[model samples]
Target: MRMPLLCIVSAVLCLSAASGFAQGESPPAPAPSAAEAQSAKQPVFNQEQLDQMLAPIALYPDALLAQVLMAATYPGEVAEAVTWSKANPKAQGDDAVKQVAKQPWDPSVQALVAFPQVLVVLGQDPVWVQRLGDAFLAQPDDVMGAVQRLRQQAKAAGNLQSNQYQNVTVQAAPASTASSAPASTIIIQPADPQVVYVPTYNPTTSYGTWAYPASPPVYYPPSPLYYAGTALMAGLAFGTGVAIVNSLWGDCDWGRNDIDIDVNRYNNINVNNRIGNNQNTWQHNAVHRDGVPYRDNRSRQQYGRQLDGASQRAAFRGDDAQRAQARDRARASMDKAGIERPATSNRQARDQVREAQANRPRATDRQPQARSNRDNPQARQTLQNRPNNSAGRARDNAFEGVRSPARTTALADRGRTSQTLAQRPNASRAAGHAISRPSAPMRRGGGGGRR
Candidate 1:
């Protein structure tokens, strides 16, 4: 009994030692939390990136620039506007905006048709447009600040100044309680209130020595067609003047980091998007976003909820219901007229059709009658007795009084010189005329003569 007890104790001790050894290795790290994973995926643009993105359009007229920033938020609409602009290249200025008033694009996007050149530049680089829009949506203040910085740099470099196309005004930033306002505000406006000219410039050179070497400014020049007959100098080139009456209605409110609407101009151009007298500040309209996803979690949380499945379906439900009603009415009319029609949704009707088809005799399934049928002697004799002059009869009927010439006639001879004098009465005269007529000059080259 003592020996057995000692052996059991030894086995227990060995098992305990093995278990402790197994527990000694380090455990795997805990999985990242959902928030951490999302943060890792989201992109946060820095000041340099914002500057790079806004460089191309930073110097645009205040009202046009404001509309562009507002439009950028709806990248999908921007793309549609690009396509529309390309399709209707001749459409521009206030007239163009009025023409697209019925379009489903955002008011800002519709207004952009006034300057096809701007849309051309925006469409050239889709990725840039998307990123610019994302940056604007995520950090409005940062984007506005970046624009100011670029404008300041251009002004300091003497590249940006008052010209025939636009008037540049620089004033000390108003003493405001809000810290978002800049030290100085630069406002650019069209020289003529009615005619707005889009400026074309190389962002890199116009802004002087670019500070961010890692993220250089993107410079997309407008097509020469936009600036035809207009002199293009070194610094900034103004394209053909776009005569706009009220297409441009939004103005950059630098102090508030938002856009302010000219209610009168807005109403005039956007008959459909007119706002109340009190509603002067421009707000982002998610309905015009058209289901485009936001880049970051913040924007997604803010505007993404505005468009739900129910609302999206509601957009088409009215038209669908109307169509369904029309179809029902048409079917009723046909039924009253004693016309038979298949029920679109009835499986039984389809099955009946298939059954009828299956019951009908098929040509392939019918056995052909044997060539030596004993009972068809009379029918065979009738077929044999039928005359084989059917073609001749048809020809005689077609040409009642006209007789066909004999096959052995001189007219049927292949040889040009094988006819007697009577048959070839005019043949010698025709030959003399052919000999006298000039033959076409022979083509020299082996290749098929000029097409």
Candidate 2:
């Protein structure tokens, strides 16, 4: 009885495989059979021993982990079922036994049990399901031959039989004839209703109709380069593997479009504040390629505007402590204006010009004074009253260099004469004539035009 209890408990270890297990849970070992007693030497497997055995293989790849777990769980359940069958030979397998029996060591069975109820769980999880099926079909139960047939069909003819598991049958009992009938005394009829009893045998298996397990691992021609080949194929099959992993680890991407939409909308509201659209470019190119996006632009814009309004209020609360905050607000406003500016706008450049104008000085900074002018009557009369001597004129010209008084007078006279000539229509011709006038037969005295 205790042995049976132990056996049943051992079957319970298979439950860990049913649900995705934590890293710490250990798989149970196959129960030892009586035949092993004759050997006098057999390995004893406790829970710890089972844990140790399963631990090394626990970190299988995501595509293969479900299969590994199923493989680990199947042996113990099969051994328990075998033990139960041996113990109660006459008794029919009950619901529990039948249920255990129904768990055909099939990969698809394991996958179905492992995943939560979802549509895509079936379609996209071929590799994982195949891994499970491979593990199940390879189990040491007596179904190997039948599974082999199925596998052969899957391989060559691309078809599997419907009755691979329906071979076991039970015969009906014959009618009892203990009491004999009297000969014509009562014109005896054949015993009215002879009842025959037939026993029904149901064998649990995964080989029946429509029980096609998941697709098997696809094989292709091997490339000469090892790592390159591995990386290329593995990357191509990565979606399948990743999906299986997500199912196992409970981390899948969903509602991706909503996230993308939200991000774009947020950027749109702050569009003026857009600093070169790096985020948008990243979202469009890398993020979209890698994952899904959120909802539309309107929500994001509204959210950003709300944040801006709240910050502005906090900035304007007139405490000296808020001065820095106010400066930040001003800076944010300018940034916003810049961001919102028209594509062809040059408002910022104009602001720079205004700043420069504000720093320039007015003309009132200089002192004022008068220059000697012949237009003054006194200066003109003085000029007219001067002796008309060539030597006097020469003296006047000499004084023009210094002394500040007569020098002003001579300079004034020269200025007046220059103005008079400048007013003439032929001023340039008159000046040329004056310069070219042959200086008193310059051959006698000096270099004239040369000076």
Candidate 3:
């Protein structure tokens, strides 16, 4: 009995040890959080959309353009911020940044005070501004790369006519060189160091050389890494020979408009100042510059921190996208209180004038003329009694669109010696014509008209 008991005890201990080893070797799988799943399903920016959005700013110097894009992300704050900037025009660069640092605005907007005009243009459309912000947040690196590429492509196509911004005007180098994009270097001393001019060309028609294989022409940059079959030129040449996907394609208003902003409340604005308000459009995965999930300090998370689970994610108010939204609420409050707007700019005046003009008809419409000459009996009589001679009939029907052919057929029969006016060959007896003698031009002394 002792021998049997010892054997069972030893076997039990061995089985227990094996179970512990198995558990140690293979850990349990982790279930995915809702945030991870949501981030995974987010839409990424396709190359074409990115390229189009970045086209206008592509010409801008890197640092300023960065501020412009970031400001564009917070479009709602733009008007108020622009108004404030105008109020304090002397405060710029570091000084402007300091003034708005404590304000409850997005860091992007705070940084944008130095550039009021960029903010103004971007503020015109809240939706586009939000889209650009989402795209930038989702893929900053990709967006930057696309910007560089379009500039290079424009250069290669000789679209970059001149470049004072880069000071890279020289003899054309191979495609590898940055200066190769411009045709020639014609340097001029800029009058204002504050201003820079960058000449551009039409991307559609000017984008040189393509492969036309019985279908639409396909354009590609002179790069071997880019595969031949890729949809490289698909955006620029859809149906037409060349597509104008440059600034002309509603890409960006790439001009500087330094005007005073009239501080006023615009009541007609949605509370959620995002492109579509839902936020997850081109939001994509949140991979930071360092390729990790990191939060921005000047973000909207402060308000949203009061929530839990999916609600917290939905309450993501830490980014410029959220902080900028506060401007909308502020604007609505001002309007409801019935505050009068400040002095308007030249642009606002022109816009108001245009609106007034669009609502009313043109000044040239004062004289009430008949829409159709066919309504006048004299006009019909003139067409019907037209002489059969080519010159006389041609002069009479010059202004007519659909003239009666019955008159022509009747006139044609009058010239025929064998056939009467009713016997002329005609399509439905209306359009047929017979040759007729020309009416003699009246001499100076003649009182009667001659047939």
After superposition, the stretches of candidate 2 with alpha carbons farther than 4 Å from their true spots are 1-312, 319-451
The reply for model 1, stretches above 4 Å from the true place, is 1-43, 177-182, 232-234, 306-451
Off by over 4 Å in 3: 1-23, 27-42, 83-104, 168-451
Per model, state how many residue pairs clash: 0, 19, 10
Worst 10 residues of 3 by lDDT: 240-249
TM-score of every candidate:
0.58, 0.14, 0.33
Q: Where does candidate 1 have its weakest 10-residue lDDT segment?
A: 366-375
lDDT of 1 by residue, 1-451 (tens): 2679889999999898788779895545799999999786555788788888899999899998998888988899899999999999999998899889898988989999999999999999888888887887887878888888899999899888897778999988767614654578899999899998888888988999999887788889798879986755437888788998898899988877889999999998887777998889988878887888888888888887643576667546655767878888999999999986665667978887888899987875553544444348987887788889989988875664345455334444644455465366477586664435566676776764557
Which is superior by lDDT, 1 or 3?
1
- Superposed Cα deviation of residue 59, candidate 3 (Å): 1.8
Q: Compared with the true structure, what per-residue lDDT tens digits does model 3 show for residues 77-134?
A: 6556767876775565445665675665554466566544444445445565566765
Q: Global lDDT of each model?
A: 0.83, 0.32, 0.46
- State each model's C-alpha RMSD to the native: 21.8, 34.2, 29.9
* Highest lDDT scorer: 1
- Give the backbone clash total of model 3: 10
